[model samples]
Target chain A: MTSSRPRPATIGDIARRAGVSTAAVSYVLNDAPGGARIPEETRERVRAAADEMGYVPGAGARSLRTGARDLVLYVRSDAAQGPLASEFLHGLSRALRGLGYTLMQYGAERDRGLEAARAWAALRPAAVLADDDRLTRAGVELLAKGGVPVVGLGSDPERARGTGLSTLVMDHRAIGRAAGRHLAGRGYRDLAAVLPAGPPLRAMGGERVEGVREAAAEAGAAVRVHDMAYSPESAAEVVAGWREEGLPRGVFGYNDEFSGLLLGALLDAGVRVPEEVGLVGADDLVLCRMLRPALSSVRMDGESSSATALRIAEVIAGGAEVHLSPWTPVPVRRAT
Target chain B: MTSSRPRPATIGDIARRAGVSTAAVSYVLNDAPGGARIPEETRERVRAAADEMGYVPGAGARSLRTGARDLVLYVRSDAAQGPLASEFLHGLSRALRGLGYTLMQYGAERDRGLEAARAWAALRPAAVLADDDRLTRAGVELLAKGGVPVVGLGSDPERARGTGLSTLVMDHRAIGRAAGRHLAGRGYRDLAAVLPAGPPLRAMGGERVEGVREAAAEAGAAVRVHDMAYSPESAAEVVAGWREEGLPRGVFGYNDEFSGLLLGALLDAGVRVPEEVGLVGADDLVLCRMLRPALSSVRMDGESSSATALRIAEVIAGGAEVHLSPWTPVPVRRAT
Candidate 1:
C-alpha cells in the first residue's frame, strides 16, 4: 500500500535525472549564489526536473542545518475550551502569521513535566509560548539549554523573571475585582461567586474568588463561593439550592458561558434577572449581549495581549530581553 | 544575550566529559541492546554527564535520519471556535495521544491554495487532517507524494476516494434534515433557517440549508434562509425584522450558540418562546438544557467521529487501506 503512493523526489533523484552534480542541484534548488555560475541549460534542466518530480525541501533538514525554524509552538497544559480562549488563540495566530511565523498549538502531558519538555525541545521551534503550568523550573532550563526562547502566558511575572522567560501575566484577580466592584456599585449587598469545578480551572477560580472577596470586604458585603461543574444539570441544582435558601441578587460567574448557564438556570427556575439576581461574568463574550436581560461582564483585552506577546517573541528571537506589565481587566456593563 | 544563555550538551560533549566513546554514549543514551556489553560504572558516568549537561535529542536530526515523524498535523481552514469544534478536537487529541501520536492543530491560510500545501509538506508530518476546502487536488497529490497520509474531515467521500485520501464525512446536511424533520413533526408549517456569515462557515451553512430544504419540500412547508453574522447586534436586527414581518414560529439556527443568541433576542423583544417561536439547534451543546425553553438540537456524535478518525489515522500510518461509513446525525427533542 505504501508503494502505491508516489515517493517525494529528493535532491539526489533530481540531480541524477537532470544529469547534474548534487551540488549543482542544491544550488539551483536553493537559488544559492553559486547557482549563477551553473550553465543556464543545466539550471533550466534542474528546475524542470525538480518541478516534474514535485520536490519540497524538508523543513526538518533545513532546521537542523540552519539552527532556526519558522515554527512558533504554543504548548498548553490542557485543551483550551470556550469562546474566549478560542478567540484569543485565533488573534494570536493571526498576529504571529502576520510576522511570518506559523503558530502551532500543542497539548502537553500534565504530569510528565521533564519528559514533555524534552519532546517539545526536540521540535527545535524558534520559540515556545506556554501556559504557566506546562513548564516547571527544570523544564524551562531544559528548553533554554536547547537554545529555544520560552514565553509563559497567564503566569506570574516574578517567577518567570528568575527563569529568563518572558511572561504575559493575565490578571484573573483584576477581572474578579472589576466584576465585584460593578455589582457592589449596583447596590447588591449580598453576593455569590460561582467557581468552575475542574483541575484546569482551579487556579483561575481561586484567584477570581480571592479578588471578589477583597472587593466584597471593601464594600461591606457578604460573599459566598460555590463550586459547580460546567454542566446544565449542575447549574440547575445550584439554582434549586439557591431558590430554597433565598438567592443572592448579585452574582459573579467565572465567565460568560458559565454566567449564561447560571442566568438560564435562574430563568428556568422562575427567577427574574436583575430584579431578583443581577449577574456578572468575565471575558465579555458575544453571548453577553444576546442573553435575555443581556449580561454585564469584565473584558480582558485579548488583542493587546496577543500583540504584546508577538512583539516579545520578536525581541526574544533576536536574542534580546524584554519585560512588560500585567494586563488589567475592564468592566463592560449591560442590562444585567 | 545569546551568549548569556547556556548551550545544550551534544553527544560529543557527553562522550568527552564522561571519557567514553561517542558510540558508547549513543548506546547508553538510546538504551540500545549493545549497552549490555558496556560496564555498569561507565554507563552510570555517561548517564550522570548527560543529565548534568541537560542533553536532549534534536527532533530535526532524528526525523531527517529516520524519514518518519511522530506528528499528526490537523490543519483547519479556519479557527476552531465554539463548543462543538473545541470538544471534538479535545477528544481527538486525547485519542491520538493514547495511540502514541501528538496532534498539532494548524490554522491554514484561507486563500493560499497550493502554496499552503507546500508549507505543510515541508514540515514532513506523518499525517495531515484537514477540512475539505483547505487542500486542493494538487495539494493532496503533493502530500501523498511526500509519503504523508492525508485525511479529509467533513468532506465529500466520493471526492476523497478520487484523491486517495481517507475521509470522515460529517454529513451536515443530515443534521439539517434531522432538525427539519423534528420541527415539521412538531406541526410548524412556516420555518426559517439561520446561516452564519463567514467564509469558513459558508460551506457548512449551505449544506445545512439544503438539508432543511429537502425536508421542508417533502412536508410542503415554507422555508426561508436568513444570513446573519455571529454577533448580538446581528441577532437583534434579525429579531427586529422578524417581528415586523410576523416571524416564522419554527427556526433552525445553525448551531446551539446561534440558536441561543436568537432565543435571547426573541425573548428580549417581548416575544414568548415556544408559544410564539419554536427553535431548534445542532450539536446539543450544554447551553441547550440551560435555556429557559430548553433548545431542541441535532446531536452530532462528535466522540464517535473523533474515534473513527483516530482509527483511520492509525491504519493509514501502518500503510493499510480502510473505509468506514459516514456518521448519522440524531435529533434530540427538548422543551423548544
Candidate 2:
C-alpha cells in the first residue's frame, strides 16, 4: 500500500486500476443512465478494482454530483425533553452516521429558538422527519413550502393525510391496550391511568388511557382516569394526595421514562407493584429493563425510522412514492 | 417590523437605524478608536440602535474576520473503547455548541495510528482536545511541531508537561474509590465490579477496574471483577452463569447503562436488592431514579462540559491556556 499507488483510492483510480475510463466508473458507481451500455465484464472489473483498492467515495463529492445528501432530520417539537427522544436520537444518529448520512435534528421544541429552523433550512436537508401530529401538518407544509420532502416518525398515518407527509406512525393506542389488558388480566378491578400533561402526547396517552378504560371495563373493574404530569416527585405527589380516591391496583405511565419514575415513587411510598399496584409503561426502552424489578411495556420497533429514512431518500431521488405503515406495539413482560 | 424599515438590523442596518455612517457604527461596535473622531452621543445612539434592532454577530462570521474558528477537536484514541469519552463528548459538545464553536471527534486507536496526527492537522482546529498520556511522544511531537495547541481530557495532566498539551485532568481512580467506599459503607465486604468489554473500552474499563480494586482494598472487601460485553443480553448471560462465584451483597456496575443491565438481570433471578444483594450504578441518568428501587451511585458533573467547552474556545481564540482539575463525583443514594 505505497502512497504512489494511490494512498487513498479514488473512483478514477479504481477505473484506471480496472483498465477503464472515469466515465464508465461513474456509470457503474453512480447508477448513471449509461451504465446499461457498460459491458458486464467491465463493470465487474471496476467493482473488483474498487474493492481491492478500498475506494470509498467522498460522501460530500457524491452529494454535489448527485444532488442528494441522503440525509434525514428527526425533529423534536423541543430539543429539551425525554429519555425516549434522546435515546431515539442517539440510536438514530449512530445508525444514520453508520449508514453514511448526516442526522440533522430539527426541534419543534427549540431550545435554540425559532430562527433555528430558518438556520437549519440553510442545510437543505433531503427530508423532514417530524413526530408531532399537529406539527406534521404544519411541518410538512413548512418544509414542503421550502421544497423539502417530509416523513412522519411515530405519527398517525390517517391523520397525516393531505399534508403530503409519508407516514411511519407509532400506534400509541395499541400500546395502551396492551398495558391496560395486561393489568386487567392480572385480575385487578379498580384501575387508574396516568397520562402526560402535555397536549403533544395526550392523543397517544389518551388513546392508551382509553384502551385501559375499555379493557378494565370489559374485565368488570371500575376505572378511574388520572391525568398526572410526569416526574417522580409529581407522580408521587399525585398518588400521595389521591389515597382517598381509593388507590387503584394498577397504573400505566405514558412512556418508559414516566413509568420508571412512577414505579420508583410508588415503591418509595410503600405501594407494592403487581401485588398491590401493577405498572405498565410504553416504548419499553433499554432502561425499562434496567430497573431493579424490571419494567414491562409495549415494545415499539425502533428500526422504522431508519427504514423511513431510506425510503425518503428514494422518494427524493425521484423514485415512486412508497407508502409506509404505522408501527404496532407488542406486550413485553418483565418484573413489573 | 416592516421589511422596508429605515434599517434591516445588520451592522450596516445599525448605522442606518442610528442615522450614523457605517464607519462610525463599526468603530462604536468594535470599541475601536475612530479613524475620524466620532462623538460619544453618536456611540450611544449606535448602541441603542443595535439593541433595538436585535442585531447580533454570527460566530462563524466573527471567526472569519478574526482568522480562527474557535473550534476544537476532542480527538480520541478510540470512541468505542471509552466510557468517559462519551460523557466527555456529550459535555464537550453541549458546551462547545453553546459557546459558539463546533466540536469534532476523531480516533487514532488502531495501533501506531497515533502517528496518525495528519487527521488532526487536516482540520486545523484551534486546539486538539485529547488524552495527553494516551498519545505517543512521536504523535504529540508531530501535532505540537505543527503548532496545534492541545488540551488533555484525562487523569494524566502531568503527562501534558512533556508534550505541551494543556490538560483537563479527570479522576477515574477517584470514581472507582467513591463507588467502592459507598458500597463498603453499606456494610458489604464481598464486592463485584462489572467492567466494560471490547478493545475500545479495554483500557478505560481496566482503569476503572483498578480504581475499584484500590477502593475495595481500603474498604477491606475481597473484590472479584467481571468483564461484560456491550449488550444487555451479555450482562444477563454473565449474571445467569454467576452461580460459581456466589452472589456478592454489593455490586457496582461500571456505568449506569451496565448497572441498569445488572439490576434487571438480578431482579429476574429473584435477587432482592439490599436485602439479598445491594446494587449501585454510576451516572445519575433519569432512568436510575425511575427504576423501582432507584439506582444509587456517583454523580459526575456532566453538565460542566459547557465550562470546559468555553475554555477550549478561548484557547482556540488565542486566550491563555487553562488547566482543569478532574471533575469530582458525588455519592448519591436511594432506597438501596
Candidate 3:
C-alpha cells in the first residue's frame, strides 16, 4: 500500500547517490574510525546526497548493532496519577533531556508482565522504568537478558527482591501516616479515613488506611473507615450519614480531590470546618488553596527530579542495585 | 559490562533446544502455512522449548521485514493540554487498543521537526500523530518517505496544506466565539476574554481571543483583552483593578482552571456573578460545577474518540486526505 511513497534511503542508497562505496558512506555518516582518512570533499558529497535523499540513520539498526539505544522507556499504568505524577514526569523529562536521553511513555494496560517486556525489548531501550504492580520477576529477567536495566517504583522493596531491578519506594503509608498524625495531633479523638472503592485504588488505599490506623492507635483515637466512590454524589452521600454515625472530628479524605469533594459536601450540609471536622488530603493539589478554607494536605517532598534522573542514569550505566525513598510525606497545615 | 548476563534466546537457540532446523522452528513458531505438514508433537516441543527459554519474537525484526509495526506513535507537546486533552487521549487509546494497536506517547519538546522524525522513524511505527505546531513539512515528508502516515491536530488547516497530514482542527476561535455569543446574547455590552500570558499558551489563546472579538463585533459590543498569568496572585491582581478600569459586565476567563481562579477572586472582590458580572469559561472542566454559582462554559462536543480513532486507522491504511472537526463549540449555561 505504501509502494507509491519514496523508500527511506539506506547507506547503500547514499553510497550509490554519492558514487562511493557503502563502507565509505557509513564511515562518513557514523564518523567511525578511519573516516578521517576519507577526503573532506568526499565526506561533504556523501552528506549532501544523504540530506537530498532524506536519509535518517536507522535507530533500530544502531540498537541491533550496539544492543542498546539512548532511550528510557517508562512503562505507565493507571496507578501513580495526579498533579504530583505530572510534576515528577516534567522534572524527569527535563533531567533526562539534560542527560541526552529520550523518555518514552508506553501504555501497559493488559500486557504488563512478559508480554510487555517483549514489546519493550523490540525497541532495545537502554533502560526500562516501570511500576511494581505491572512488572513481574520473569519480565525483569527477560529485559536484563537483553541488556536493558530495569527500575521499578513500588510501595514495597521485597516485591523486587531477587529481580536485579532497582527499586524506588513511593511510601504511600508514610503519606497516610503524616496526614493521620496532623489531624490527630490537633486533638481530634474521633477520626476517619476515606478510601476509594475501586480496584485500581484498593492496594494504595489499603496501605494509607493501615498507616492511618497505626497513627490512630498511637494517638489513642478511635478510627473509622469509609468507602467512597470518586463522585460528588458519593461524597454527599457519605456526608449525609456523618451526623447519625457520630461525625468524626477528623477525616483523611484519601487525596486532595476526594478531600475537596468531602469538604464541599460538609459545608453544604451546614457543618463547620476544623470545629466540626478537620480534614486532611494527600498530593497537595493546587485545588487545596482554591477551596473556601484552604486544605491541609500531605505532600511528598525532599526528592528533586534531577536527583531521581541521576539515579536512573546511574542504574542504566551498570551501577549497583539502588533503593530510593524520594517521597517523604510532609503535612502542610492550612485553614482546614 | 552486560556480558556476564545471559543473552536473550534467539530463534536458533530455540531450534537447537528443540532439535529442529531454524526453518522448521520459524514455521512452527510463526504458524506459517508450511508448518501444517510438520508433526503436531514436534511443533508442541518447539513451542515448549521457546517458552522455557523466554524467546519472544522480535518486533524490530518483523518491522524490518514488513515495513510497519502495530504502533501508533503520538508526539506529545506542551501545546495541547488540560482535562479535555486527557479525555481525548483516553478515548483514542481505547479505540486504538480495540484495533490491536499499541499507542506510545513520545515527548517532543525541543525536537519537533526533522530531528523528531528521525527518532520516531526508528520505531518503524505504522503512523505518527502529532500537533501541527510540532510537525514540520520536512519532518512529514521524511516520515512519509519511511512509509509512516502523519496525522496532525491543530487550529489552522492551511499550515498542513502541503504536508499530506490528516488534520483535526481544534477550532479554539469557534470556542471563543461561542462564549462571546452567550455573554453578548445575555445583554452585556462590555465583554472581556482572559488570555494567558505565556508563550506555550499564546497561539491557541490568540485564536480564541480573535474568536471572542468576532462575536463581540457582530453584537456591537466592545471587546477588551486581558493578559493574565496562571496564578492566583495574577487573578487577584486583575480583579483588584477591575473597579478602577470600569468592570466589564461579561468576562471569558480562558478555560475552567483560569475561570475557577477568576471566579474565586471576583467573589473575594465582592463582585456578584451573573448580577454585577456574568462569567464564562471554555473546556467546561468538572471544577465548574464544584464552584459556587456553577460556571457557564463553552464545551467542545459531538466528537466521539472512537470515530476519530477509526478515521486515524483509515488514514493509516492509505485512505485519502481527511479533515476532522470533532470540536464543535456548545455553550453550557449554569448559574453564571
Candidate that would win on lDDT: 3
lDDT of 1 by residue, B1-336 (tens): 335645456899999999999999999988888878999999999999998888887775567656657788888766556677776677677767777678898776563457887887777777888877887888877777777777777767776665667776678888899899888999998999998998778788999999998899989999989998888778888899898888897999998888989988888888888888899999888778767788899986544645675686665566444445545789998876
Please give, for residues A1-336, the per-residue lDDT of candidate 2 as tens digits: 321211234577777789989988988977788789888889899988865654545333454466555556555552244545554455545555555554544333322222443333333556656665425243344455445566656656576666566666556666777788887777777777887787767667888877777777678877677677756778887778657566788777878777777777777888777677778788877766676566788787645556645555565554233456536677788765
For all candidates, the clash counts are 0, 9, 0
Question: Who is ahead in TM-score, 2 or 3?
Answer: 3
Model 2 chain A is weakest, by summed lDDT over 10 consecutive residues, at: A1-10
Q: What DockQ score does model 2 reach against the true complex?
A: 0.14
Candidate 2 chain B: worst-modelled 10 consecutive residues by lDDT: B1-10
DockQ of candidates 1 onward, in order? Answer: 0.58, 0.14, 0.42
Tens-digit per-residue lDDT, A167-208, candidate 3? 887787888889889988898889999989987777889889
User: What is the C-alpha lDDT profile of model 3 across B205-252, one tens digit per residue?
Assistant: 998999999999999999888889888889888888787898999999
Q: Which regions in candidate 1 have their CA more than 4 angstroms from the true location?
A: A1-8, A19-21, A33-37, A109-111, A302-306, A318-326, B1-49, B64-67, B302-306, B318-326
Rank ordering of all candidates by lDDT, starting from the highest: 3, 1, 2
Better-scoring candidate (lDDT), 2 or 3: 3
Between candidates 1 and 2, which one is better according to TM-score? 1
Q: Return the interface RMSD of model 2.
A: 11.2
